[model samples]
Target: MIFSSLLFIFRFLPIALAIYYLAPAKLKNLALFLVSIFFYSWGEVRYFPIMLACIVGNYFIAIFLGKNQDKPTVRRWLLVLTLVFNLGMLFFFKYTDFFIININALFGTSIGLLRLTLPLGISFYTFQTMSYTLDVYRGEVEPERNIIDLGAYVVMFPQLIAGPIVLYKDVAAQLKVHKNRYTLSEIDAGIGLFVLGLAKKVLLANSIGALWDDIKVLGYANISTPLAWLGAIAFTLQIYFDFSGYSTMAIGLGKMLGFNFPLNFNLPYISRSITDFWRRWHMTLSGWFREYLYIPLGGNRRGMKRQVLNLFIVWCLTGFWHGANWNFLLWGFYYFVLLTVEKLWLHKPLAKGKIWPHIYALFFIVVGWAIFAVDTGMGDLAMFFSKLFIPQSGISAGYFVRNYGLSLLLGIVCSTPYPGRFYHKLCRQKKEVLRIAFLAVLLLVSIAYLVDSTYNPFIYFRF
Candidate 1:
């Protein structure tokens, strides 16, 4: 279930946390593992077996890799086999339909679409499991000998559905020592963070998302250039807060459970360059590609030409990884081009500027969101871009600005680091009571919104 839902907030989380706290230290992992399975299966009971198989399959594969460290041939084959299994499951579940459609289009064949409902969190947990296998083979981490510990890591509900994509090595110690590390301070911090993230999702992202949805419900032809731009900008805010808000909740949940997941977002909207944006946005994914895909392909250590090619490959895969849509590919390639230009020429001059660099960065970022919003064909994309640039269209800018102006303003302001800085400054003044009250108010308001509304949807669930 989504973190924002009343069912999750009122019932599931409370019950789960109660059980977890009541369990003895030695049984905590078992409690978490069982609850996590319940969490995953709550929405899709049929996929429980699939998720369990992944945990069991990868655990044994990692064990084999760890055991055969001295046997290069065996280790290599095992690694390849494990990777194939992980990636094979991912592709079959996530991309089989896309492949069928593409083949039908190109070969003039009428292949039926599989239309399989993708197993939730398959993309994220598959990556997690694969990383474990790779780390074991490389001697970066000892294989997790206990299947329950491994299963808990893979299926932990906090970051399971959408993630910062926790790596095995990063959390191996935490898992081993998790039972011994419960602290009141950590739980307090987690409560504050969880409330703050809840407010971001319920108060900010969901409210702003309506503006985009309203415009979208009005077809592309019904929006003027300014309106189109405003809608695109609204979506940009919606996605940032939605994904980042969920990440915040995940990290907070990790804290509550005495584990630490890495931070996923870093105020990416404040970035002044595409290169800077990648470093800040969905940072774990970028780091994943850099470590597993980019660096292995020789990174920038190869000459500029090979580096460029490597980037292109990574971006294409990155886009394809997001979905089966062509627009996602375009979105990926769009960044590739921007990043390539930045590397080749733009970085120096952009770094030299102050205000203009931010303007430049935001201009491309807004346009990029427009590309991301459209999921269909290039023709619709062309039409949307035409309306965005041409002034020949529908609604007046005044109406949109009048209606959504405050939300837009709040979105712009909150996208920066100032709000967080202000909060920390308040905390340093020995304002513990004030901080507690603020979080309490935020939690109450968020709960009210959750009870009243059904529009809550975490955007990253599709991935």
Candidate 2:
């Protein structure tokens, strides 16, 4: 169930929190694990076994890694095997159909598509488990001996589906060492964080997303230049707030449980270049690739040529990680190209200017999202790109502006750090009553919106 859903907010979370707080000290992990399973199963009961099997499988794999840690060759072989198992599961569930369709078209072999449904959070949990095993092999962190704690870490519902991709080492200490888990102040802060995130999703992302939907319904070929740009910018805003909002909620929920997940997003829109953008956006994923994939693949240490090839590989894999689609691959390579350009030449120029840097960043960012949005065919993407440049004779631009002008303005404003700064400014004045009242209103408004509408999908769920 999505965090924005009424049932999850009113029923599952409340019950889970209550049981967790009421449980004995040692039983807290058990409590969380049980509730997390129930929460995950609420979405798809059939895949529940797959998730459990993963937990069990990885738990043992980690033990074996720990046992053979002193032998470098044995540890390397074990790490390879564990990654293969984890990544193999991820590929089979997520990419089997895409591969099947390509094979059928390429060689005229009628390979029937398995059309397998991807298990919820398969990519996330697999990465988490793989990281754990690798860390154990590398002696970066102690292996978790208790399967219960390991399961709890993997199945933690808050960030399970869409994550900042929490690493085992990050939370291992909290799980095994920390005794006093919760504080009233931390819970209060969590509530405030969650309320703000709810407002971002229900009030901002969902509302702004409607404009993009309207453009899609009208079809890209029919849209004017301004309308095409408007749709692209609207989606760019929608996805940021949607995914970042979910991450904020996840982090807030982590705080409520006295755990801290790494922050997933900074003000990425404010970035001046694509290189700066990756540094700020979905930070955990980039860090994961940097440490586990890029660094291991020779990184920049192997000279410029190898570094460039390494980046190409990482970007291709990163794109395919998002979905089983060619556009995603294009989107990945698109950034690879931009980042390569920046590294070789444009970095200094883009870093020097203020207004122009922002303009440059925003132009490419919007264009990238346009590539990300279209799904059916390259023709549709080409049509959208054409509309973005050529001014077709249409009056939809004025109509969209009239309809979503305020939302667009709010989106642009909130994309910066101004609202957060304003909130912090208020906090400095000792305005406890004002802060609580504001959060209460936000919660009420979000609840009202949730009750009234059903267009509340978090964009990262597909990944």
Q: What is the lDDT of residue 372 in candidate 2?
A: 91
**Once all C-alphas are superposed, what RMSD does model 1 give against the true structure?**
1.1
Q: Note the Cα lDDT for every prediction shown.
A: 0.89, 0.89
Candidate 2 accuracy as lDDT: 0.89
lDDT of 2 by residue, 72-172 (tens): 88777777788888999999999999999888889999988887888888889888888988888778988788899999999999989989799999998
On a 0 to 1 TM-score scale, where does candidate 1 land against the true structure? 0.98
Structure candidate 2, residue pairs in collision: none
TM-score of each: 0.98, 0.98
For candidate 1, which ten residues in a row score worst on lDDT? 173-182
Q: How close is candidate 2 to the true structure, as a TM-score?
A: 0.98
